[model samples]
Target: MPSKRVRYPFQVLALCLSAWGLAWAGPPAEKDKAPDAASIRRGKYLATIGVCEACHTPPAVPAVPGGGDPDRERLFRMDPDWVRYLDPQRQLAGGVPFILRLSGTTHGLVVTPNLTPDVETGLGSWTEDEIVEVLRTARRKDGRVLFTFPPHSFYNHMALEDARSLARYLKSLPPIRNPIQPRTLPFEPQPMVADGPARAPQGRTRERATYLMGALVGCRECHSHHENGTLVEFAGGSPSDPFQGSFRLGPDLPLRQLEKGFAAFPYPGFAVLYGSNLTVLGHGGALERVPTERIVRAIRQGIDVREDEYGRPRPIAHVMMWQFYKDMADVDALALADYLKTLTPVANPVGVRLKLFGTDWEAAFQQTYGEPPTPEDRAAFGMP
Candidate 1:
């Protein structure tokens, strides 16, 4: 037995050593690693701050099946809805069908485009770099740069990490394959006032103005009104009926109404109340018709261009006019004006009459005046 064991091993040992050497070599260096779960969650939170859902998620009705029922656990789960309304063939397609009364007559319901990851119709093909570039530069595929993109600018003040997280969250969304039509503006193209040499700022001034107007000041939020009378995120214009000069300011109308009343009756006289157009032109298409110098004067001095029977400059009754904006310097106002010039014109055909003196107004006035009228003792009160 000892003699046999000694003879069998020499060649076998060399073979075993060669096999072990091959086993030690590992996989190639080019393989990718999976994304971390933690990162995905962070991205989701960032997306909320960026308010992506406000645009992507279709508005739901109170009792409707897919309407946004606040009580529902999956309130903004857009995937299933996208598949329902959007064309199945289109990648990641989804839209909200909404009837926007631009004015009383000029109205139509259009779908707000879906932003999903379907390769054919969604953003499945877009790179992270492209998303970042679009937000930063406001350039579309055709090389036209837009000044604003709604709630995205709300996150303009967000940290870089937050922005990246939002981008990642957007990527994680299921791609819907619906191609959206380009948003149309009502007016003809005009050169941006900011681009002109007269009022253009240089170096730091330009950069500072851009940052303030785009992010901090949020001038666009009030300036842009949507077709449906909604404030279009960073888009300019108040949701004003261009013809009627009235729109909802959510629940803040009392303060404005009081201010208007005070301005109208500075000495207890009825004053005509007018709402600002918020367009580059002052209200009543004056900005479009008047010269820049005149526009500046109206904004600074609260002068109304339209005259009464006497042809005197109508006492500027719009109390809120230039008053709030007056605090801003000439340069700042001009910068704001420059920013306003780029707004996409939405045709807000004047809607129905907005009763400024409604029950609420009467109630407020009564509170200030005191005592309800009494019907008793008509003769005693000199009735006949």
Candidate 2:
């Protein structure tokens, strides 16, 4: 008390400054500030692996008329330029048409919504919390449920922090004023796929890989069992054999395939490709003989480094969505490779490992889906 009575004004001022510094350096300081560069950077990475642009971004050229699957040839073509087909200026300005079907019956065209931050046309009015909620619950603020195409069931399993990061990144984007058409569903919506498992905790590399494969990257969707286009079961030793891969029917030519069943008739040539068995359990499972480096190559470069009958690696079909996965960070891709090697290798072979090995797929594509996108079209999308 005697010492305080003798304290100078400068000492009191110094004590106040010290207390202010401690408060400013605490956790709340970081939390209260706007989304920093690191968080935005993280969000960009999450968006890349999640393939948000695949659905949300429209094509550079107008889709072939007749309102059906736009890039039907994409199912078979292994062109590395597939990524350039999307309109760059309109990135995430959703208008991509996804034809959702059930038991071969066409429900309707679901034009993806614009994800930009435009106040009038995009998610500008949506708060960060609202965007995070959509990622968690797959339902819009208006209480409308989402379709299965975006594969919300898988995305809903994303970690909370990751989802928040995604929202922040999206909100930070330069707003684009692209108004999307409402989804045109001819039939009542039906539940096509079941929800994925709960979020895997953040820690080990394998756990991160698990979430990437099962949730964010959605490896289990096409890789899982599907009789036609309809998903039969999700995972866990069911006769369906999760991650065992599925038989993918080819393009919806003349838009008739959607009206009819996906399995009503076989696609021309090797169009009826099989989703390779990603598990190591099955005897003829595709990845069983493939090395980890090859898997990483396939994921990052869209080239299946697995040896063919002639012992040469080939390009993966464009339908595999490697163009999107190609953007994944090395650490994430490596983690996925490590985790896949640890699966309970299931021996469920779906189709021939090298269906396109001997076929003239380019000529077939020209005959079926018309000449591939021209260079002018590619340039429009900002591809060299």
Candidate 3:
């Protein structure tokens, strides 16, 4: 027999490597389970991270019990008591409107749709698999491609089980009869990606990120500015790429402003609000230079990101949806960061910090919100 060190250690090392290799070998394909309580629970969690309520929820509704099924008659009557609950049981019944913009020009206005099981106004007519297919393709029940939903991309990349969970949860909701206004599209609906919805290859470093961030997490949607229905820029690329001017920041932005972590995003209700330029060419230096722990906080909490010259904390823009993403798995967030690092840089420098609000971002956030998350408060939020 070989020496003990050579025999035992090498054998163990080989075994460990084999196990590690299989981790990224891609998920074993399988059929999904039937919808159940457990699925609803999982879907509820994923939907929260997906920020379903952010777009789907209307501005306000009365807080009341979700008594009786909110069927067609209840919706028609518009009963206050039938509508409200803490978990937004009245949610996904879509009536929220969003202002679509590209380079300060009005693209169109679209309304959120009711996702309830209402026979007339909601998904009651749809089959579960149909919903999943629509989600995966960005094509609606009628084959129309949904253009503006950033989370749609994220949802499309979810595993079958997770995607099913979300669908099951939506079906579990009380189907209220809220007929939402349809989207006003400039072009006919089509698949989001060039080659259509293809799953990532079995094993590759960027495969998951390419699938998730490109379409799933909606990173590409926020970071790149497109022209004539094509993505022409990537926000995280090097500064010298030819596609620099293709961002939504418009071609008029100054380079210096980008250095200060400013970029423009024309929000639905607000004027063009600025966001961070997430490129290696120039960054807030918060994500690039900070420790991994702080980076996680920035992505999860959105606080302690910016600082005044005195190193005091400043506020980040709410446009990026850090609140909804706070629940993202630490692993996923890290994977996103790592994949982002591998992207080719674009020279698109973007900024107009707080132009829409006519106030400092920090002051606005401070006035409206409480403190950033602390590790001590983890238990309350379910962290270990």
User: Which predicted model would earn the best TM-score?
Assistant: 2
Top lDDT: which candidate number?
2
Per-residue lDDT tens digits of candidate 2, residues 180-227?
A: 768766454332232444333443388677777666776765555644
Where does the lowest 10-residue lDDT sum fall in candidate 3?
Answer: 6-15
The digit string of per-residue lDDT tens for model 3 on 60-127 reads: 32223233354532331232121122135456676654433221122444566777889898888876
**Which wins on lDDT, candidate 2 or candidate 3?**
2
Please report how far candidate 2 places residue 56 from its true position, in Å.
Answer: 0.8
Which residue runs of candidate 2 sit more than 4 Å off their true CA positions? Answer: 1-33, 63-80, 103-106, 186-204, 226-270, 281-290, 353-384
Estimate, for each residue in 141-215, the C-alpha lDDT of model 1 and write its tens digit.
445543332333333353333334344556776665556545432222211212112111222245545654443
Better of 1 and 2 by TM-score: 2
The residue pairs that clash in candidate 2, if any, are 280-345, 281-345, 281-346, 281-347, 282-346, 282-347
What is the lDDT of every predicted structure here? 0.35, 0.52, 0.45
Count of clashing pairs, candidate 2 = 6
Candidate 2 residue-wise lDDT at 347: 49
* Clash number by candidate, in order: 24, 6, 13
Worst 10 residues of 1 by lDDT: 7-16
